[model samples]
Every structure is written in C-alpha cells, then in structure tokens.
Target chain A: MASRMRIRAKAADGVTEVKALMSHPMETGQRKDAEGNPIPAHYITEVTALHNDKVVLQAYWGAAVSQNPFLHFRFKGGAEGDTVTIKWVDNKGESQSDDTKI
Target chain B: MNHHRRTFLKLGGAAFGAVATAALWPLRAIAAAVRPNAAFEATALDGAYKQLGGTPAESADIDLSTPDIAENGAVVPVSVTSKLPGTEAIYILIEKNPNPLAAGFMIPEGTEPFVSVRVKVAQTCNVIAVVKAGGKLYSAAKETKVTLGGCGG
Candidate 1:
C-alpha cells in the first residue's frame, strides 16, 4: 500500500538506537472538515519493533497521539550491520512494515 | 463596543463552564473492569494509577526526557528509559489530557528498556512515565511548559 515510513538505526557505545517516522493521518474523529462534516477516527493503534527477528518494543497508541508519529528507542546486542524492522497497524486493520540496517 | 464586550464575556463564560464540567465528569464505570480502560479515562493521576494495578512506583530507576519548555504542544518529544532490569512495559501519561493514557509500550526480552515519541500536550502539565519491571511498577514525572494549546483547544 506504499506505506511511507522513514527508519534509521545506528550503533554506538553498545547500544543500537532506532528511530522511525510513520506517515498517517492519525485523525482523532473529533476534527471537522471545512464543511463541518466529522472525520472518522483513523490512527495507528499498534507499533512493533524488532531487532533481527527478535521483538524489541511493542507499543499501543490512541487517537490522542499527534499526526505522523515519531518513535525512537534503543536496544542492546545490535551491531552496525544488523537489521531493525518496524511495523504499525492502524485502527482500520491496515498495516505496514519497514526495515532499516544499523 | 459595549455590546461586543458583553458578547465576548458571555462566550467566555460558557467556554469556562464547559471546561469545568468536562474536567469533573466521572467516568468511573470502567474501574470495575479487569482491563486497563479506566487508566485511560481517569482524569486524575492517582486514579489512573489505581486503575493500572497500583504498586508503589519508585522514581530512582526511571528517567523521563522532555524539554522544559515546549514551543509546540502538538508534537512535543518525550522519551522514557528505565535502568531497572527485567523491564516489561512503559507507559506515557499526560496529566491534563481528556484521555491521559498517551501511549504504552511492551519491552520484550533481550531488548533495552527505552521508548521515545512525540505526543500532543493539551496544555502546560506534568508528563508521567510508568515502568513495569520484574513485577513491580516504577515511575518518573517531568513538567513541560507548553506555549501553544493542542488536543482540540
């Protein structure tokens, strides 16, 4: 579905820092269009991060989160060439996964 | 000009009333449930802690990183890192939001206990980070000054 996610991973001082930027509307269902029509709630509900196929971080989010959410974290046991994967699922059952090399 | 001032005052009064009522609304029906729904709906921090399975939280092992002054409330960078071993989960809470449970993260084994993200802040309020590790809860809080209002304000 052409999910737009920018991911970066870097290794330093025995810690691998992973940062990701996911693109989504993140509508809270409380906003109204210019014509005053209510926008339905559409937001990323779950986000999971993996380090070389092992789960590192799993997050549950709500609509109160800001648009185009940014996620960052650090984990041990990753080298400069290791791979980190990030996946997100929205409230509407849509999902996306992306990977980056440290 | 007097009529305009009176109209503005009336609107202002009505807005204040709405805010006061919304803040005081008791949504405790979910408290009896076994799930974590009440934690999100609870307006007060202590009440939310109770809803989330209260265990005395210590602040020594937790670190909450945030700018002292947030120029934009729509996206304020917040991060939580715990030095405690066997950390299982971390939760972010904003004290004054309509629904304060901003985000919760489950930290799996072999992973470091850390999480960072941008969250919306309704106003100048304390941002609390709760960590569950080794079957116990720990927390740390920091106040962020927001110059701009977010969260439907």
Candidate 2:
C-alpha cells in the first residue's frame, strides 16, 4: 500500500534531523455528524522512527493529536546516504511506512 | 492401556496451551508498549498523571513553547525540549481537554530530547510537557488561550 507520510531527513555535523507529516483523520470520538450520530474514534496510536533499521524514537499518541499530524525530532550518528524510516499504526490496526535518504 | 492413553492426552493439551501462550506473548508486550491506553483515556490531569505513574516536579530545564493565543483551537503548535541529562521520554498533556493526555515519546540513546507537534485544544488551557530523566519526572507548562473549542460539534 502507498504510504500516507511525507518524510524528510537531513544530516549535518554528525546529527540527523527528521520531519514527517502523516495523513490521518484523528477523530476524537466526541463529535457528531450532521445526522447527529457520534463519530467513532479513529487516530494514530503509535509511531516509530528508525535510522538504518535502529529504532531511534517512538511516539504513543491519542485522539487529541491534530489531523494530519506533523512530527519533528533529531538524533545523532546519521550520515549522508543513510536511510531513515517512519512507520505509524492507527487505532484500527492499519499501518504504513515510508523511508528516505539522509 | 486406558490409563496411559488418558495421560498422553492430558500432556498433549498442556503442550498446546503452552505453545499458544508463547505465540501470544510478543503481541501482548508490543501492544502494551505501543499504546498506554489508560493514560490517554484519563479525563483529568491528575488521572493522567496517576496513569503515567509519575510525580513530576516543576522544572526550569524543560522548555515548553506554545503560542499565547491560538486563533484556531483545532490545531495548536507546541514544542518541547528537555535539557535534563539522560532524558528518556517526554509527554504532552492538555489540561482542559476531555482526555488530558495527548502524546508521549520515548527517546532512545543518541536521540535528542526534543519534539514538536500539533495538538487539538478543547479550550483555553495549560499545555504541559513532562520529561523523564534518570528515573525522575520533571515538567514545564504554558497557558494558551483558545478562541474556540476543538473537540465539539
């Protein structure tokens, strides 16, 4: 399946910075539709960032995270041409991953 | 012969149970580690804190940045940086949200204790960032006024 994430990784001075934007509804289950029925909760539950297969950061998120979530972080020991990957799993068990070069 | 057959059947059942448990162990562990459901379901700040099992002290070493006024409550930009040594994790909480806990991040070795993300603000409230370092919890907070609520119809 095509990934719903856009990732960018850059290396400088022995450090690598990663920024990712993911597409998700992030419904809080508190809102009602036009018909007045409650919307079911749908949100990303977990996010993992890996540098060359090594897990560097992991995020656990709730419904309060904004729609189309944006995340930014940095880690050491990444060089140019190294691979960085971002993977996310939502509450419904749907998962996607995307990788980019630093 | 009948007694020996019964014993063999019992052993087979026990072995099957053991295999089933072993197969499910990793999935259970991964689910628990991936999502702290109790923390996220907590509706109050204290409940969220209790779920996290931390008594955090107010700290100056943690920097929490948010706009003084959020024009749109639907998407408020927030960032946190921990200057504490050996920082292992960071958590974000919105004090007035229906569920106070918003997000938590695990910082592995060689990773910087900094993160930026957008969150939904239910109302004007304090946004707190908690950092776990060296087995201690430290926190910093900032208030942001919201013109409209985010979590309602």
Worst 10-residue lDDT window for candidate 2 chain B reads B27-36
Q: How well is candidate 1 docked (DockQ)?
A: 0.38
lDDT of 1 at B78: 91
Error of 1 at A34 (Å): 2.9
- Computed on C-alpha atoms, the DockQ of candidate 2 is 0.78
Residues A1-102, candidate 1: write the lDDT tens digits: 476699999998888888899998887776788788898989888888898888788788877678899998888879988899999888899999999889
What tens-digit string does per-residue lDDT give for candidate 2 at B111-133? 99999999999999899998988
Residue A101 of model 2: what lDDT?
A: 92
The DockQ-based CAPRI class assigned to model 2 is medium
Q: Which whole-number lDDT from 0 to 100 does residue B134 have in model 1?
A: 80
What is the fnat score of candidate 2? 0.93
Q: Which residue ranges in model 1 land beyond 4 Å of their true spot?
A: A1-3, B1-38, B41-47, B55-58
Model 2, residue pairs in steric clash: none
